[model samples]
Target: MFSEKDFIAGQFNTIETASFEWSAPSNIALVKYWGKKENQIPANPSISFTLNNCKTITKLEVAKKSDVSSFSFDLLFEGKPKEDFKPKIQKFFERIEKYCPFLKEYHFKIDTQNTFPHSSGIASSASGMAALAMNIMSLEKALNPAMTEEYFFAKASFLARLGSGSACRSIKGQVVVWGKHAEIDNSSDLFGVEFSDIHPSFKNFQDTILLVDKGEKQVSSTVGHDLMHNHPYSERRFAQAHENLSQMKGVLSKGNVDEFIKIVESEALTLHAMMMTSMPYFILMKPNTLEIINRLWKFRTETHIPVCFTLDAGANVHVLYPENVKEKVLQFIQDELVDYCQKGHYICDQIGDGAKQLN
Candidate 1:
């Protein structure tokens, strides 16, 4: 918690310049934790490792003002101003107000940049929401240092979900959890778990991003989940998801790459299965998507090299392979997947560091 003397309320005037920045990596979930209970919370607990190359860097500043208690941000896409994203900025302001009511009294200017493309299915939402939440909370801490850092992150993540579902996972460490399970009140106590005990296996992993396409999805995750609920197979899908969750935890806990590979591949397929079995029978996977999956399997079978694949609610496929085997996977992707893959679809890597303060 920050201290009162340090928490200069209107001290926005005394401090000429106050700034903070953080570079947070994107995360990939081994056990696809989906479905929300309270305000887009997940049904079961899930774990993920933050990726290395893929990340979002954010910086914020506060200045004393007289005219308007306003907020603005320079949103960019591929290095160009993205004024169309103003609504998202507005939503950030609205959400922060709910947490730190005092924010309504100050004028703020936020600047954010995404190393990854916007809405390209690379967890851009995760990075963006994390940066915003952390930056604003930094401001609160500066004013009144009494706030606990963990509590601040948790509250920020809890609110960030209003902006995006996956943002909750961004609040924690190298590994994180999403859903009500992460919430303290949950009886299950199966919240987000960071793998702190073991020596990190993914620290050196590098991600070579493969940006298949930036086109929006035909059906949003929100709509897709609704369809799943109404689908007659929904109940069965939920049961299978529960089972997969348990298996994924075991595979990761043991650090058995072989078992981990099996669990990830199965979980990816199962997620698609749930999607396919939806009442209306919508298919999120494109022909190219299937080709990528097939290539991964063939590469594994032929070369005895192992790589993992995970997909969210879109066509983009995240390929996970070790640094040692990267050349093999890269060559294989170039030969088999390049033609079908989008011009810019190649991000590769493993787990990454958690969120923290930056100068």
Candidate 2:
């Protein structure tokens, strides 16, 4: 049974307590979501998986109050207070109010924790914002009782987008599509397609996270997106993402690994291509970044392994290889790429699960 005890006094009443727990999984872009409209609307719809290892657990308790007209929350990262994160939290609240005005009356206390390192380029913001948004919806249901699950997901995703572009997809399960194309207003297109939907023929496909350099990226995603407006290759990059998403969908539907690798890898390169062409010309690739890529290509040519490499906004390299050849692929990375990598670097994990309410 769930508890509905009251812990704080309210203007309507006093000493009321109720709490709910929710978990949100991190996501990896099978087809990346890049560039955005004013206020962070995605340029094109993109899909991703909910990761198992990277996630955030959020608990929220809402108290009714007539005297106090504001909502408050305390945020923590790995059990330590993260005061710097408050502005984003406040912005999230404002976005929620814009969409769900009923929440304006209730005061809230929120607690959140991440399972992975916040500094890791693992998209922790995606999972964290998703968890926070979902928990807010649960509290709304307790207060009004009329909020439907779909309503929760819709409003929560809208809130999540304000926190981070990738966070929008983490609000749902499995394969989530985020952008206006998915829905006219703010709503997810589907609950998610099953992980097996990726294509049975590609069961051998796998990804390796190679930390070429742990130093912070010079170009942040936010800055990168803004640079697209003036980038010489922006149009090409946009067209590539569109084609990549369509091609990846076909590969999933047809179980085509060959096409999958080609599209995913090319799309990643195209994204970076845009970054390099931006005004003032920023290059994310360090010497080690190029070395790993160069070695991976060489190894693929010589060994004939079905392998591909993709890079996100960061310098880390995500090596895609066939599952049967995973050991060989890992060894190649260790022998050829590990020496160039920084210490305390490069951890690997597979695709993960979506967000869920926890008991």
Number of the predicted model whose TM-score against the real structure is largest: 2
lDDT of 1 by residue, 1-359 (tens): 22222223332323444788876666777667655564465655566666655777777766655544565345554456677877877876675454555564555566677776566656577767776777776776776677776556655566555566666566676656553332222312122335443333444444454556568877777777666556676666566656765565555556667877787777778777877877676777888788777877888888888676777777778787767777887887788777766764666556667566668
Name the runs in model 1 displaced over 4 angstroms: 1-17, 64-81, 119-121, 180-193, 197-209
Residue 219 in model 2: shift from native, Å? Answer: 2.5
Off by over 4 Å in 2: 1-15, 144-148, 180-197, 202-205
lDDT, model 2: 0.68
Task: Compute the lDDT of residue 7 as modeled in candidate 1.
Answer: 24
- Error (Å) of candidate 2 at residue 331 is 2.8
Candidate 2, pairs of clashing residues: 5-17, 6-16, 6-17, 7-16, 7-17, 50-352, 52-352, 204-322, 204-323
Summarize candidate 2's per-residue lDDT along 1-359 as a digit string, tens digits: 10111211122222356788899987767677667777677766676655566689988777666754665666766667788988888887775565555555656667788776566665577888888877866765666565566656665666677778788777765556564332222323322223335556554346577777666677788888887776666676666666666666667768776777787777677767777777867888778878888888899889888888887787878787667788998888778888767673676655555678996
Q: Estimate the TM-score of every prediction.
A: 0.83, 0.84
Q: Model 1 — TM-score against the truth?
A: 0.83
Each model's lDDT: 0.64, 0.68
